[model samples]
Target: MSAPENTPQTSLVHSAYRAPDGFEAFPVGIHHASTVVFPDVATMRSRDWREKLGYTYGLHGTPTSFVLEARLAEIEGGNYCRVTPSGLAAIVMINFALLKSGDDVLLPDNVYGPSKDLSRWLQRDFNINARFYDPMIGAGIAELITPDTRLIWTEAPGSVSMEVPDIPAICAAAHARGVRVAIDNTWAAGLAFKAFDHGVDIVMQALTKYQSGGSDVLMGAVIVRDKALNEQLELAHARLGFGVGMDDVYLVLRSLSSMRLRFDAHDAAAREVAQWLKARPEIASVLHPAFEDCPGHAFWKRDFTGAGGLFSVIFQPHFDERQTDRFVDSLRLFKIGYSWGGAHSLCVPYRMAGMRDGWQRQGQLVRFNIGLESPQDLIRDIEAALMAMQAD
Candidate 1:
């Protein structure tokens, strides 16, 4: 009564189906899928993709991405999270979801460089006004908020200048004016500070940094404690069609387990090196939030639990651009690069002339990203670089 085994029907049934259910493992399985199949037509039609009750499409999210999202949300003390292609993408998503024509957004003068660029682009293309406020404005940010202001962006320990801000005060100001507060919490890695606890509505991070820890992956996440705000971000994320590779998500998950350890190591080593640099005669100033001389060190002491491995040092007034370049080039250990939160130490010389509004320090500024290298070795590298500059 049965059909022949070699028949086309039998071949199709056998080749199309295989079940690996109930497989247990320490690591989450990488689910590389674009199309998900349903057991029945009714099941497929009834599924709500937006709620994350079940898998819908690869672009929206996969099991791997969901796992990472949940973990990141928990770490950030948020209820919902959406991962994006990069930190900048997350910022764009927030902007697109929240801002419209006749709306305005406020940014810290010393925010991440690319963020300012994106704000300018939005202003040009979308007619959304972009305003820059001093990072230390704190509650005084209220003065800048207008009837048209819809969003405010904050960055603690302002990017390369390393000036900490009064996050709680800024949040209070923004919230009182009915404006949403979003912070670039990359420096904290969502570990050094509790963003939502300070009244921040949206918290974003460049997971490419500490979460990946290898400096090999580039991914970002936006976390929100409110459901409505989360819905807006989710809609923008889906429309943008941003999707992260499963392998990269898995790498971040793997690194996240060791993130705390690595962060602590980096924090300790950086303090030692910074102190050494501060003591050197060639240094004009060390812009570290943990130290009193930094612009908002008091706020940093009040808000942050710990400092990360990023800080900038201004060379003596005599060190010109050429000398600074020589110093950066002569380093044997610290590689010159833009990003941070890796095992390899990095350094970059920056001209602070036009980047900030109130910057008064003379001489060239060099930012350092301390890595897993021994503190003494990094110090020696800087010492040698200084010596090299002296010789030249």
Candidate 2:
């Protein structure tokens, strides 16, 4: 199927562009580039505005880097894409491009913690006003919009709590108000869902996770639908002088070749793990988009093909945070760490009380990122951890 994704590197993308398209992608390879030599001055000018197939400086782009950008856009089903040094940079670039001083932006309460921090930075520095609405606000997001509301951010199955939003409905509502919608599609990784298919205008992804696969590279991408809007974002990006290492781009490209295979494995394994976790008597809930208990499971079922390696398991109501901490500390397999979508298993407890206001929840949440390890072994890890927690 799909030629086993083994097509030669020389093959033209979509069989177009008769230019040099060589170099088989590899996992450990990195193309270090800071300056690009142009064939002529004619090509140099083309890099002036992301205008043509030429590179002016390393910060602008290089052939190696362009290849990865093109492949990411292709896989994500977006017409335009921009790269940033980190996932948060992508978010910052989007804000810098779309928002002006005194303009307002809305974010999901359960969004990534650093995102809130970034928005606050914008608010404090640029006179921008930022507010957080509940992730489950969905179509109700319309009520929060105002004449100054310029950007509306959405995250399907919002971070930590895993509250999937009604993206189509939110997009429609924002479109009606002439506001743009940007989604944190990092969790979906473009394999499980297509943002544009749901009427999203901008799709932001933290490619550091699934795209890099190795957990070594930190890169991000912002895919925009409208070329004109994309140009504006590009200007801000150029001003910020954000540049990704060509080597990191190559790593992500190499990961793309195996994306489908790896994604399917992750999905199947994650589903099994989530199901088992839900069945455990010690677990009060499994906060996974695929689970019916998730806030917007219906939307997840309709829009997403699969889930990644991340999910959260809530301890029984009677369990205290101390007990949960012991379980996490006693885990032999799942290492306690931050971030997800890596090959190694990880577990971390999050206090909802600190993350949000009036957040209602009992028991500590031990977020899990199941690795590529066998499902049975992961299950045993969980079993043993729970056993140790009980023993203590």
Candidate 3:
């Protein structure tokens, strides 16, 4: 048989070279593709995108993405998983999957700011009724469930306000009403809190934080034990085109092995700093779940095995917002930023009055994300920042 001659362009596209087989490593192989190839047309026709048994398209998932999803699901103790571009994207996927026009959703008062915005958008544009309830509502959540209520969103120890909701109570109430409860379990990274065991129907995590461990990737995942629920989420994923990059998936996979260790380090360091802040006269309140004074602290202690680096503090009324801002500006190690779970510490100040309904606290609120740095160094930096605030 003779090979057919081709133009330079055709030759470039038609190379038949193949890599040797039997190559294997500890790391998962990254498979990047847009148009997935099948051995034959019949095989392609039989392949289902919903099933992870085989690849049909890049958006649906590749081996790399599938591996990442499997790893995340395993970590979270879920049977199925779908990855999204960001934590917010995971929230959006769940909302779009389960709710439609005329459906009602319940959100915690202290839910993530962006999720709150999303609920409002859904109400305004999509006609989905969005309502907010106290994060500590617990069993009382049953009172909020209406005939139209289809979903309830919970964030363990609300991201900014730091109120750890009683998940089992809320889940019991929601499930009784034939409603599904979705939780933003990003704070725990599925290591500290087990959402499924706590009776949550869907668990969403922002892989951007501890999972990445590098602060370089932004990814999220929705995990479920129910096959039907996973199907709904997968359909939404496909319709919304929520595809993630393989490189990011690889980065996450590379860091997954060390996530628990890093998470523990962050936990230990955070608790130490939180304890120090609790004693400071300049700080009115420390809003870490592990702290006894934090709202719903009992619930946190009951349900969680660990608290990650994220926590908040309220400056004394005498310090005011200006002084707090000065203190934050004076921080040398804790950089001002949003999102947590990296090697570098971060600080963010929130206006509770503006963020919450009837926020009664008078002092300014500041959230801290303790990194892998030494707790002593972070405390020293905070001490200096406090002195700077006093000087100002």
Candidate 4:
């Protein structure tokens, strides 16, 4: 349901609107459609099920989802893209399409929390062999690929720790082995990291986060390069009944119009906060890909164009898990929450042990989802929390 990269300006081919007739001025309108009427029984019958030539049911495809997919494909520089109910659904579609019971999949140890959980489930339930490799594996991934391996899942700057991996190296290794490469590009949101440009065959993202521009809608999308793999995913998607709500699709489209602008704000504000926290005595280090202490700052600088609003800050030597909780609890501007990419700032504490590989990084991990707030105010809030932590 995505727009072609080489689409001519003649008209919006997939768009329900006739551009010659003059579409509405603002590009932010939400196209709400559940059931689209066909011209005739012949046309409906002739519709291609293998591809999204046309639609049959609401759950299958809608005008809003179709338009969103087109725009997403344009953004990701991919040939095809599809919308799903959530980010995990998009991952599941890719997995179910590419791998079978005996097939093997390589996943980076530094993946999204839910994605890691899903991989474990896929191993136990589907009997698909999935293994986790370190995010720093890079070109060394060539050593892990086997004939049975079908897919490789990677996430740049693993969620909590923000470790930007050598995406190109990883993709080259997987692609050389004739394996598919998919990434949770939700962190970069196609803004910081261009997946298709890096040889990624498939790009998966949580549109619910940055794309929605709000915390309301839950949506995800998967971008594919080849038609065959895209068709396979489409079949799995149809069988699984994975489709986004029409209203949610509308909301996502509404947010997408200003996606670049919102991402700009997020990047600026987050950099400010990260820089501020780095200078603070209560903060041990800033775990942002753009920062020096981050796991792969060199890779981030080399491969990525920019950073996002989400990052983590390690507390100073004096702070422990208890003080970290106290600081989070004492915050006024920041809410203790899991997800990011909303209008509100969020803070979540994670145990260093839960995401460790025998590394001796000393600090309680506090993930920050910076909102569209004034940097000065967020700085003030952090100062207050630090004061509270100091008093405690």
Best by lDDT: 3
TM-score of each: 0.96, 0.91, 0.98, 0.91
Q: Per-residue lDDT for 257-307 in model 4, tens only?
A: 788888889889999999999998888889999887788999998889888
Which parts of model 1 are misplaced by more than 4 Å?
Answer: 1-20
Model 4 poorest ten-residue lDDT run:
10-19
lDDT (C-alpha) at residue 22 in model 2: 73
Which TM-score value belongs to model 4? Answer: 0.91
- lDDT on C-alpha atoms for all candidate structures: 0.91, 0.85, 0.94, 0.86
Q: Which scores better on TM-score, 1 or 4?
A: 1
lDDT of 1 by residue, 84-136 (tens): 99999898899999999989999999999999999999999989999998888
Please tell me which model should have the higher TM-score, number 1 or number 3.
3
Q: Which candidate gets the maximum TM-score versus the true structure?
A: 3
Q: How accurate locally is residue 151 in candidate 4, as Cα lDDT from 0 to 100? A: 92
- How far residue 322's Cα lies from its native spot in candidate 4, in Å, is 0.9
Give the C-alpha miss distance for residue 325 in model 2, angstroms: 0.8
Q: For model 4, what is the error of residue 88's alpha carbon versus the real structure, in angstroms, after optimal superposition?
A: 1.2
**What TM-score, to 2 decimals, does candidate 1 have?**
0.96
